[model samples]
Target: MAKPVADTFSPSENAAGYVSDDNPVLGFSHMHDSGTGGLPSLGNFPLFVHPGCPGDDFTRCAYSLTFRTTSRVPGSVTAAPGYFAVNLTNSVRAEMTATQHAVLYRFGFSGDEHVDVLRDLKRPDEVEKGVPYSPLVLVDLVDLMNSRSLGGILVSPETGRVMGEGRYLPSFGSGKYDAFFCADFKGAAIRKTGTFVGNDAAENPKILDGVGSGFHIPGGSAGAWLQFERPTNNSLLARVGVSFISIEQACENAEKEIADWHFERVESDARKQWREKLGVIEVDPTGVSEELQTTFWSGLYRTLLSPQNYTGENPLWNSTEPYFDSFYCIWDSFRAQHPLLTIIDPIAQTDMVRALLDIYRHEGKLPDCRMAFCKGFTQGGSNADVVIVDTFVKKLTAGIDWDTAYEAVVSDAEVEPPNWGLEGRGNLVSWHSLGYIPWDDTDLNGTGPMSRTISRGVEYAYEDFCIATLAEALGHAEDAAKYRRRGGNWRNYWNSDQRDVFQDPNDVTVQTDYTGFMQPRLVNGTFRYHNTRACSPVQEMHRCYYDTHLDTYEGSPWLYSFYVPQDMATLIQLMGGPAAFVDRLRFFHTSGIAYMGNEQGFLPVFQFHYAGRPGLSAYFVREYIPALFNASVNGIPGNDDCAMGAFSAFAMMGFFPVAGQDVYLLSTPFFPEVRIRARTEGKWSVIKVWGFDPEGKKKYIQRAKLNGRMYTKNWITHDFFLKGGTLELWVGEEEGTWGTKEADLPPSWPVEWADGGGVGLDDKF
Candidate 1:
């Protein structure tokens, strides 16, 4: 597993750095997404560390306290989904807590004697250790009950040496796509009292040791320590709050989550939260290698971090102005994370939509990417369209208010400003507005130059179809028909002779060059094809470039073969009928052009399965799963958004809950016995494979049944899983290999208006 990105909590000197088995990079301060996207380390948490003597890596040169030696509790220590904790021999414990805006770490070290004294000192610069530590002294410490807003001191039994102490500060972050929603929390400095000391028995220090009171640590490691207890009532737990609001809001959150418990109870509850979430998907595979299983669970855990708890009765943290709290990876996540949310947790899906709608109402425009104030992710096309379209398609909005969902979808699309730059002009949208964005049109407003005009036409046409689908669902048939007809807008950009999607035939000879050949040069790797400017019909900076001898976007002629979704029958006919379509799909699948990594490729890859090619999806899954198994490290997949990467992992596990429709497509399994435990339900759903004919790679599903009944249906509806149950399958490597005598194909109903134009709830993907 790649090292967990270090924590952003102010990281004082700890050890040679800590590495949690969950994700090694995580144990450090300044790590981004202690459980999600990798963010830069900003040194948010600052604790002082007294250096050990020159020779001491551990002993002679020591930190502020005596190092306790033991394995930090795993289940006892949760990380992410907001909490963390570690058991120090079950006596001395540590934990961290987080709200949408801030984190508070609470530590508990049992007092050795009744007269333990909490010391107040800084990192001694003139150390006897290898290197001098940052010199800083405790300015104040508070006892919660009495001077709830102020600081006080401690007289605790001191058994361990003092490492040091300091406060962490927040600074503006560096993210190009940071479209923020947090209300100016960016500039609102983190107000942690300087050089603060935390001990149990300070004056009026909140005594959390009563009955049911506790503290919950964040799921990520922030670092912790404990000192001996002392007289003077120094055995109380000090609450630390970092606030975007006054220190007051932070205190409220602390008080609410931790009123009666001391350190142990709070930490225990925090760890339990993680165990509950991770227990979502239980695994039981006998043959899959250990590496594969480990990687598998690790990736699944990563998906559980976003669209988290944000709605508080106070509403400050949920506000969009100062970019309240909840954030999402819009650019990268729409393709996967959003879809995953629909399946894994529809309620969460609704809430995310709800928060977004809230933002839209407050900000006047829904964000391209959700953040506090600035757009920190990146801008692209009608992502909101994809999100809602994909959402409604699968009926994931069952629990959400449809009227509101429709309003959000339609309203967001209507208000979306026409895009600029590459995506706007690329083949993802229509060119009827400007024929085709000129490849060099970045300098202009409406028209940007495009590599292939057809792609642009098709993309815009696709979005139009999406909008019309929603409009039709709301009884706007005219709007639906208009979009449906416009969906064919890409024909204008296609050059039949070139057999690919591209700009209209222009007199200006296009320069067919490569972005990899630019200068001494900007080394081209994954994005070399992004140099669309050089493909101008008219040469400006040099020669107008083309993607190949063909007139097309970055896609090959084969890929552009059958991407028109609305008219699949025509698409199948265009490819020469069902059998021919199947053959072409096989060609694409076997060829490397079936790039699952991109947005456009998923449908086609699955189209092969839908086309009824025996074992095609099974074959695809077999190859795709192994690729992902070898691809990502732990949970991090270095994609623009990690969602697709996670999706790939989800698929490889043998079942892809197809988006837009509530069906789960069965694929060949990497593991013989697979158990997928859902997070929303306490039930365990298992898929068993048996009765297979190894010969000819039999993949034909024959006589499929659910439970004990003889059921034959290709599409497994949402209702099929109302009370989650086991789905058993009998497989074969060859066609007609299973008992085809009784096997039934998926039910194919008449295509309704809702399928494309949003006429009814009959949406299918």
Candidate 2:
């Protein structure tokens, strides 16, 4: 659900605390991605909740959930996803719940009097533009983005009137706001009305409407809230909040997308759906804390939430009605999200891959930014190469012949060239082919394109490493050796004097006096050159690349530094010592310069645990857990692109494949107690904990056991969490004497990484 806690419209929705007289309570809506930079949101409600008092302050209300929601439910109770309900002064213990697609709401009113379960009768329809840009740009933009327009086919099969008001609120960014189709729609009487919130807005109880009944949904973007009235007995009041980008599609949902009925039926269905997806990982966590539970589960929520049903399988995919899905920064996520897909949920990942691959087959390549059925024409690189290779290396795509994946990956890399998504990318084929992409590789006047080639040269090297490692594991020695040489492409870019990673020419010695056009010095700084003390700009552009677009890029530089995980050892040596790496990571965390409040520098913050600084990772988990779990009121700080944001939280809880490889790494705990309801395939197993006292401090896991058996490694394999498992981490406030070294972080050989053994294949030639 895309509900925003900040704008819960209830008392304590976020900072404003309680509801003000100016804005009375309406039924809480669910699901929404914050509309920023003139972009739009997608989500809708499933019910209409009308409290008798139209304009009463929240303080006067009977039931208030306050601010007691955790990461799993970070929003206020009223802000919770699916079914969100609360008590009111009007004699109703209102509650709501959502089943993957449909919602169930039950309201317990003061009297046995028939309450409203009406369909389309509460709020009537109209046709015309809700508002326009320019003068009302800020307000109307939200209206436009959240799919709110005043014009639509309001055909009445039977004559009747509905009541409701509309409004727009400030968007999170500079000039934006969220639009809504909100209204009480309740004049007074209940039971007599049959109001069913569906895609086809029906006015008469028996008659149905279709496409002609749909509206403009200003800005050509979408997101809406439907209030579904759930009838109840005695005092159990329930109403489901359904949020969606297309009210038309939302109406089509229950009948098609997410259907069926029943209370536990929906909840059980959701659980079953989640299990099918989560069961891909067989994680057996030991000594988990309660905070981790919320953080991890919530994190899981983030990953599974995105890249909704977007395009279709035909040529008409882009123009279809349900064409838009998956919004976020692909530049950052493509590095890990796509790779992580292979390890956690191969089935869903398969479908996702097929979707992107289809895009490739049709458009000659995949798009980095596809928003609302349109090409955003955003940043690019030969990411499709990286994605496909990582999948083939991990052997994740089932059903698709491995040869198909291999051919897709290899052929694309050969033809697309480095920085494929960037303009004039084909020019660097030779340089990338030879390993390092030099500054003067091809087109000198093509500053942006050449720079990207080099950057992608570095990224491609990463994929090569994955491929090499995987090949070696599969006994393809010749292939492994060939790719290993290719993986060393980063070496060609290394500058000894600069002690920096630069873009190199096909020949290792060829270099050029390059201009950092992408991140023109804040004043007079160099690109990846200065080692002593960098001007703020270097750090700012690490995660994000500032350019012709605007000022700030997606992520900060602090977070970007540590992403070269393959060279952690070399980076350590270059930085002077492991102690230096520790110091830098600590700086990132303590200074707030790294900003864990967002997702950019996410991986760097936890580098401590990987570097034998268990105490450090532990301290971080404890220190920053609160902010991480509650980073969103909308859909995460920036773009979730689905559950990638959630998985970041999941990884934060001590388990996740590092950089999307099948390597699991564990960290210290932020909370004293954590619990995950374990279900293997379909059978549920009671997961319990004891070492996490809920009173421990900066607890570093001293020991771990899987199924009560002690294990050597701190991380789980990709094969684990997916097949149903449990992890019981022990809690302590200090580092263990058995901390592993950074070099030993990810197994250097596939044989040694097969879950229960080690092989002497370090640096095999």
lDDT to native, each model: 0.40, 0.41
**What TM-score, over all chains together, does every model reach?**
0.60, 0.61
lDDT of 2 by residue, 352-383 (tens): 66666655544554555554333433343445
TM-score, model 2 to reference: 0.61
Candidate 1 residue 221 Cα shift, in angstroms, is 21
Number of the predicted model whose lDDT against the real structure is largest = 2
Poorest lDDT segment (10 consecutive residues) of candidate 1: 178-187
Question: Lowest-lDDT window of 10 residues in candidate 2?
Answer: 132-141
